[model samples]
Target: MPGLNVLAGDLLNVMRFYTRLPLPVFRFEREAHALPDFRRAAWAIPVTGAVVGACGALAGGLAYLAGLSPLIAAALALAMQVAITGAFHEDGLADSCDGLFGGASRERRLEIMKDSRIGTFGGAGLFFALLLRVLALAELFRLMGPAALVLLPGIAALSRAVALMPVLLLPPAGSQGLAASVPLPGLPAWLLATGIGAIIHAVACLWLDLPLGGLVSGGLALMLMPALAALARRKIGGHNGDILGGCQQVAEIALLLALSSAANWRGPL
Candidate 1:
């Protein structure tokens, strides 16, 4: 087995690719390893999400410029994320919604979440989620122009960063949910790093002249997880991997909607 230092280094190497940081790696080994911990990959989830979100925004913006319907572009961009991540969180979100609403017992809910097959509730939940995202992106693209294209990935990263709050504050409820499998991050370390990330995101927004869009709107978007975490803890007993992913999806959607609205009402800063 690789030493702890080597393992940590390897993990960081894999993670660097997901974040905005620039790091180089050897060519031969780049594609050799399968992502070992999909649960641990939560840290990287937002980074990958940001990439896909940016692509979607770009597709939307370009299509709008080319006279295509804004909705198509937004939908395609959303499709891109679904394609890239295989709708990983969306699946989690759907399963979670189904489990939350349809399952009668804790065990039954977990079982329903574990089933790979999509249920009626899950399907409907997914449709609404995607529809909301598509419509939201279309409106933003139509109104915000190129800035909308550039900010999607950043917004995604920020929202995922927000999802970190639960991992920092709450314990996993399930014995086998993905969050339970992921080693709990040291609260101080993760929160400190997250704070820095949040500051940087805010600074970027301000530097980009997003005005009230950054502080007020951005802050509101980021607030979803803590609120949801409080609700989940009260209702479900604790956080789980599905809950974490669900947090990410919800945060992203909320941030996008809030920012888009802010950008519309408040003129360029």
Candidate 2:
């Protein structure tokens, strides 16, 4: 019972660290302001992420069912998700793009990534990423109806865990932010996170009678993302919060597109 209680606290800690959601804390505490112990919270990443994703799914599904255009519903869903997370991952993608493309040297790249202002590459990246997500989701909802929205929680959860796995191998880019400060999880923790993500996605797919597009997307991300890791290593020496965020964003987009394509192949979603 004590172990379960501790686990629950750890999960809450992860949620507090990763999101901007308003959650209850112990009465005596001002708030959960301390950084989470990622080492212990690693397994809960997918669980916390899925909760956020489900909020978006519920919002979009309700809007579509309420007779709004699927595109508008999709946009609303995306907006809700952005609001919930405060666009945490999207900001990372922008920084990554700006740093990787706009800078001529490793130092310059890191500097660009650390800057608060978005550059031309960053702006372009943000536009395309958001556009692609909205369009893919709209098409998905059109084809699959509400079932499409149901897949989001699983995708959201899986993307987060899978995208950060590379960090287990790579070192930090600098000695400053989350990438540098958080304790590394062991192989067991990563495996636990991955296994839980897969199970969550599998249950959702089975419930919807949909193909295992989550696995396919996850596999593809694992295959393709070594390049990103290598690029980061060569460009800025190691991993950072922004780079990890970029990974999560890319993985999430790919999962959405893969599921959409798969549903289309299934005929009438």
The root-mean-square deviation over C-alpha atoms between each candidate and the true structure, in angstroms, is 4.7, 1.9
In candidate 2, stretches whose alpha carbon ends up further than 4 angstroms from where it belongs are 27-31
- For 112-184, candidate 1 gives per-residue lDDT tens digits of 7778888899899888888888887777767765556666776666766676677766777778755675455
Per-residue CA lDDT of model 2 for 1-269, tens digit only, reads: 23766677778878887788998886444335666667777889999889888999999988998999999999999898888899999999999999989999988999999999999999999999999999999988888787788888888888888778668767888888877787867778878887788777777877777656656766776665677888888888889999999988888888778777777777774
Error of 2 at 206 (Å): 1.9
All candidates: TM-score: 0.79, 0.94
Q: Quote the lDDT for 181 in model 1.
A: 56
Error of 2 at 187 (Å): 2.0
